[model samples]
Target: MAFEELGRFGVWRPFGGFGSEDARELEALGYGTLWLGSSPPGDLVAAEELLAATETITVASSIVNIWSEPAAKVAESFHRIEARFPGRFLLGIGAGHPEIAAAYKKPYDALVEYLDALDEAGVPAEARALAALGPRVLKLAERRSAGALPYLVPAAHTASAREILGDKALLATEHKVVLDADPARARATARPRVDFYLGLQNYTANLRKFGFTDEDLTKPGSDHFYDELVAHGDATAVVDHLAGHLRAGADHVALQVLDDDGQATLRALAPLLREVA
Candidate 1:
């Protein structure tokens, strides 16, 4: 009924750039987990460093790309991290975008093979989650991994993913928060990122199902769409956005504070985010 390991909320930050000290600060701030969303090297060596730095905060990959990092190698890394950190490490994997991978096949099938390899290589199912955005993959996540980790989605999508994942699997949603109250400035900061995502078919397809129109899905995205997706404002506004996920049946919400990142921002926002608990 709960992802006690991941806790109720966590911070989603770049895995490679920040170090153990940054992780320690987030732990001190009361964030339950440190989700590594930015792509790190295939070895997951950075994750181990973060684990060594903190006693209680969990460290998870919002995703490690299955395309770039082979399952066998990732599986080996998984085993090593698990051996050192045990339950504190969670391996998150994704099929990635066709534009990103030259050999992007039927992603669902590719993901199936990846999971199979992980199974054979001693990567436990409970220690992993899939960055799934659709029904087919969401079902696979429920059956094979811990659960679904949907990104760049709204509370509506979280509700849908929960239905697809049912009660057993964890529904950990990745939500972005910009620490600015100005609507125009916030959307401006978020638009370029949204434009890049618009090029990805997987993200666009999922957002469409969530009721975003073609015009809304256009480059830079409509202001309404951007505003709905990014929780742009002060810490209080961001907490309200994170709560929407919990209310929509999300077991955990990965707090991805956009643009203004690093240890200082986490420290500044910690008190505000912890109040939500």
Candidate 2:
């Protein structure tokens, strides 16, 4: 249940052939956790595989959707993983977006109800986190789970989230990174990955709160927006940018690289990550 168990830095990637394999390597590089993002299995199948891969690093789901995954089933899956891995699994759950929700009513109410179900199903509050962005949800995260996992947000949002969460709960933010020397190509790599997110109200509204203009949020996202959110350039520059999130408020920054070969990308940054550690 302790946040430190999750580590100070981690890698957040979609399920891939090298997921567990790369997880072992990241562990050696001094990373504390490996997060499987972009909605994972309702059974938490990946969590078991991840924990089995490394001896110490915590394995977390960036989110399991509340609208789709039943709390009882999810809790059961958590127990299954924890039984084998013990304290190495973190269950991050979210209400998801309106577009994906079958019946998106009061999302806050749904999230609360979901948490209540987890509480009844024997899921410990310290083992889970809410993918919250707004104030209401941030407050809910403070009370219900370990802390908040805000994705596609700037350092300002992390500062605000930390203020709302206070000092006790964990504040793990996802920082998208592109380690490329070429500005055009680096931004090109990041834009496509986040374009769909801009369409999602939760992400866009959060961006607006940080003072992003309407123009900055358009189709491909403006240069200013890219520079504001993504950590690009060489390995040192990217590491420095990621450090800014920690300086702002993040307890941990889950690095999400915008590259086809995630394993290779991380390999290149091993030295930089070591310096951070």
Candidate 3:
């Protein structure tokens, strides 16, 4: 199935912590998809377990790093998952940050080569999506693959991406949501998480394009930057903030709830799920 058909919202979780029971619960809660983050090489085994435990819901890797995992291995895993789950698996691939890679080469070139390898290995383009943030990578995703799955982006970026991708390509944007209503504490809790990505050039560049100044992109993002990027406050407020993405041309939104515990995060988000759906 095409990425656009995956519906309005999905759950984004780190692959390590969630078990089959958690997967089943999310499926029962009416999430159309489950996106696993920072998965290891050949880690689709865990994805298979989640897929096996749930029915109807689609499973995707928020990213399977291009550096560590070979295209052939990924292709094999894709085939295996597709054989069993069929239309329920969506492959989200990316050239992870240069700092993390052993070789530390040009990411765009590496991503193109990786996609070429996947193509040569007989992995159909429609079965995959890209984790792209910049204009060049977003265009590449439209041309070489199914669509783009951009993380931690605002609605303006989604609107810009839609213009670049035109009408047909899928545009799924990931948003981080915090359930806290207290402004100061919410921003405090979100600061560390936001700080990590603030130094990344892609994220910084995207923020610039979205009208944020260099000062706004500093160590801890400015209040203006944090509020735009991270959706915080009550369930209703969170839903209203997310709706901006849909209004801005996002085909789907993957939500990552920020909380000390994953179970508590899901529980807090339970009420907002139906609004997103």
Candidate 4:
């Protein structure tokens, strides 16, 4: 089955953290999708409520940890949400970081098993997506699911992923945007939030493949690293940065704003919503 066509750029934030009223407002603002970040087990049902409250906007789990939720449970949730919301729900599942899943042995293998179980439970391929960074996992996503949903990556990776998945599968990427124009402050605001991921081998290796040097991958991210990973400055500047992902072959881009205040961040991004739609 074909999922709803998401716009080039959508808003990325935590679902439970945002009020239903705020979600309605975002839907009314012409945003094509809402991507929820790192949710706990059984949160997909709550995600469905957010989608049900809005009209025409797709709501996706930026990633639901495969180790945290069993495929059977995920399938049940998917069925319920799909029956209720239909094409508006996209299951974005991933093998979470090794550190977090240290107790769960063989994560990659476990992810394969999870996907198998999801299939056994009758979740359709087009209704699901994988949070893949490497070529191996990207190929797996292509064969087994809808496509790859890569996070904290550059446009070059999107181009490569498109090649790996071919033209039919989705190539949705997550991008961080800072409304601040000041380079230092913007990087500072984005650093700690993304620092942990930079330390992860999956993210670092992806950055390295995209031509970021070992020096560029250092802690808090080098200037070059920050510049490429986090888009900063005015609304137009942020829009320009996101456009590169489309140019590089991404099917969809989810924009996560890093700002001091949530309300202000939404307000600052209002003008750019027109460009996104």
Q: Per-residue lDDT for 48-147 in model 4, tens only?
A: 8787788888888878888777788889988998888888888989987866676567767887998899889999988889999998899999999998
What clash count does candidate 1 reach? 0
Candidate 1 residue pairs in backbone clash:
none
TM-score: which candidate is best? 2
**Residue-by-residue lDDT tens digits, candidate 2, 72-145:** 99999999998888899989999789877877789999999999999999999999999989999999999999
Each candidate's clash count? 0, 0, 0, 0
TM-scores, each model vs. reference? 0.94, 0.96, 0.94, 0.93
| lDDT (10s digit) by residue, model 3, range 65-136 | 988888889999999999998899889999877556777588899899999988998888888999988889
The predicted structure with the larger lDDT, 2 or 4, is 2
Q: Which segments of candidate 4 are over 4 A away from where they belong?
A: 1-4
lDDT of each: 0.83, 0.87, 0.83, 0.82
Q: C-alpha displacement of 52 in model 3, angstroms?
A: 1.0
Q: Largest lDDT belongs to which candidate?
A: 2
**Which portions of model 3 show Cα errors greater than 4 Å?**
none
Instruction: Give one digit per residue, the lDDT tens place, for model 1 in 30-57.
Output: 8888888766666998888888878988
Count: clashes, candidate 4: 0
